[model samples]
Target: MDESGSAASVDVVLPCLNERGALPWVLSRLPQGYRAIVADNGSTDGSAELAAELGAMVVREGTRGFGSAAHAGLRAATADYVAFCDCDGSMDPAQLPTLLAPILSGTADLVLGSRQPRRGSWPVHARIANVWLAWRLRRLTGGKITDLGPMRAARREGLVSLRLQDRRSGYPLEMFLAAHRHGWRIAELPITYFPRTGKSKITGTIRGTITALRDMSAQLRSARHLCRGGAAPSVRDTEEEA
Candidate 1:
């Protein structure tokens, strides 16, 4: 373990929706000393209760979108840094230190976990979408990001300073784009991706993919406009049902 891991405080945010079956496993694997916060998006499966029982701080977001829940968790974070990962059993919390190391060492402001997918971990359609999206992001931001995988970490204040406003799947991409525009140093580290326990809310169906693409397209356009000297778009709470 790095010495910084012991000194730097971090809060891991798990944005979940009806992930009761996987929450126990995910929470159990979290490293000692890191606060875990579960952002529940109105789950009927008692996920919030279970997470709270497992010693995680549970924040309930009334809205129903990935970005809505994620943003709630980020706001609830009270540590020097915040780390986010899916609570669907696909990402191992034990590997969180890998994402935190660079940020703790002052080498990077943002650390993205590049997924090394296990067999059957990533569907073909999802893989294609991720590849294309990553390529487009690299082009737009002139950054070397390869994967927009969910597992990531960054300084809490820096992330909040970006003033991200997307309330859908576009949230992650918007963060990267804004970080790039602000000249924040970003780095990617490979992490294992396991098969999830439940059906995916996004990337599992064609409709989900299309909806995510639409949201991302809008964010990309805003990014381009900002890069061309246009003023940053006003932040608003817009909900998209996905």
Candidate 2:
């Protein structure tokens, strides 16, 4: 139901890259009434085909990046609300309705699923980095947002209104900070987390973790400066200038 108290369509965007191993379960687990859009980012394992065969609308993103695929899916969505979830099976799509409740009720502009990590589901070092980033966000927003999780739901138009610029690991951060700057009411809901079915291409290895930290930290720094100056700056824009 949307804020108008009527039924609303939802589009769930699953960013894919050889996630064929997990697609079946992930797609199957999506809450009823939610349409799946698998944004395949150059997957070589026939992930796109499998997703299409599984009845999901598959959109190919040649520009390979989490943000590239996610943004593409967002653009393709015609639903009243849009959600993003990892195709690696780390998150359960059944909980999406809970996350989206706030928005549909007009209580929040954006809602993020805070991961309640199960043992071995999250690496200690990566947890530390995530903690630091969350702390930075709290300091910037003065709100209690604990996790920068992949599972989130928001209005499709509000997201498009942000004109989010990042097409990499920084995309999530960029979107969060931009929403804050635009005075969006952001909220978080806790969800159970599990180990990914396949090896994570990002944030599962040292190199990928480092790259994420680099991008996220840059976004944090830019947001900090924005806080001081009341200017909404973006990480990718700052990097492009350099």
Candidate 3:
């Protein structure tokens, strides 16, 4: 049992790039009884070493994509439930229980931590983009999803069955769409969002936003095609799962 007097049953996966400055803060705030997995995407700032020193299992992935790193972390997770949180300091690791509660109570399969942005936490342009994308998602899936924030949790088996294929920014969208298609129960809870410690790789610049938009647009199109009775692509487990 941990400080909370509960046995650890969740693996919290942090898909990190060069988040050395933010990782320590995030790790320190994590609630008790949760295993931390730092999925390092070629961070040159010794992020992996820091995570290991902090007692997190560090898994290094050479592929430089958010989805790739996230998937790798999920594959390495051994818990019955897995949670994803950004290591960029914007998300609070202490609030993880909010995402995990619904899943553990059999009320939801996936629980997203919707950003209740603190003052100055979000840029105007990014907030507008997120609102539009979330609107599109609600329309496409007929679900009450509000934000596609990075902080989320789901059952390990249910997530794996989605066979998510996006290796870029579209990964989160693909997960939602595929989960909806597969009849997985999804929910969201509001969480505090703070300013990040360093520059964001995505949503920090016009070019990054455009690239992310392109990738997610393609994913939305593919989801539409699949919904229209198109053949499903072959699903394969990651090497870790194999």
Candidate 4:
């Protein structure tokens, strides 16, 4: 922690979308010692106003994609490290230290928060979709990306290098592929996951499912082309294959 009460000199970015129902609880749970910024994706629920009231610098993302909102938040960050997460309370903010551990210790440039073993939490369709997407991403990137969980930490420079391309559903997988292609050291830490409050914006809908599948497939195809040039071993690859 620093004198300014942050775990590291990094900034935390949360992307919100009418998260007013649960955003405050998430904010309150953030490790007291950290500085945070909230990027509201044109929420009419006063999410931006509420976040401002809670002392988080709020940036507006008129575009309505998870990646777009996060990118907007990342731009607002001015720190050596930038961590991005959803404003939903499913992820534990207290475990931020564990997620940032690899980066802080110089072992990794990107830190992903993997969900611990769980079942019967979310709808069966969501679970299945998550598993399928993760499997495809791992196969495409040759990295054992266990979960597409949104809680992630990364060094600012490497993160910027990723140049996250997807403005929608494929963002996490796209970021991982970009990092892998650029030889950024990536690591993951197990974190708890729970069903979030409020209706999910991405599940149990045909459009959502199609969008996720299309985006993942397109990104994976592009990643294959990128990997045909060369391959960098992933931390998971070394651990498992060795």
Residue lDDT tens for model 2, 144-217: 99998889999999999999877878888989999999999999999989998988887887777867777787
Q: Least lDDT summed over 10 consecutive residues: which range in candidate 2?
A: 233-242
lDDT measured at residue 97 in model 4 versus the true structure, 0 to 100: 74
RMSD of each: 1.9, 2.4, 4.0, 7.0
Task: Give per-residue lDDT, candidate 1, residue 188.
Answer: 96
Cα lDDT for residue 149, candidate 4: 73
Candidate 4: segments with Cα more than 4 A from true spot? 1-7, 117-120, 229-242
Model 1 RMSD in Å is: 1.9
Better structure of 2 and 3 per TM-score: 2
> What lDDT score is found at residue 215 in candidate 1?
78
Residue 124's lDDT in candidate 3: 91
- CA displacement after TM-score superposition, residue 90 of candidate 4 (Å): 0.9
| Alpha-carbon lDDT, every model | 0.87, 0.87, 0.85, 0.74
At residue 82, candidate 4 shows an lDDT of 81
TM-score of 1: 0.94
Candidate with better lDDT, 1 vs 4: 1
Off by over 4 Å in 1: 1-5, 232-238
Sort the candidates on lDDT, descending order.
1, 2, 3, 4
lDDT, residue 211, candidate 1: 73
- State the local distance difference test value for candidate 3: 0.85
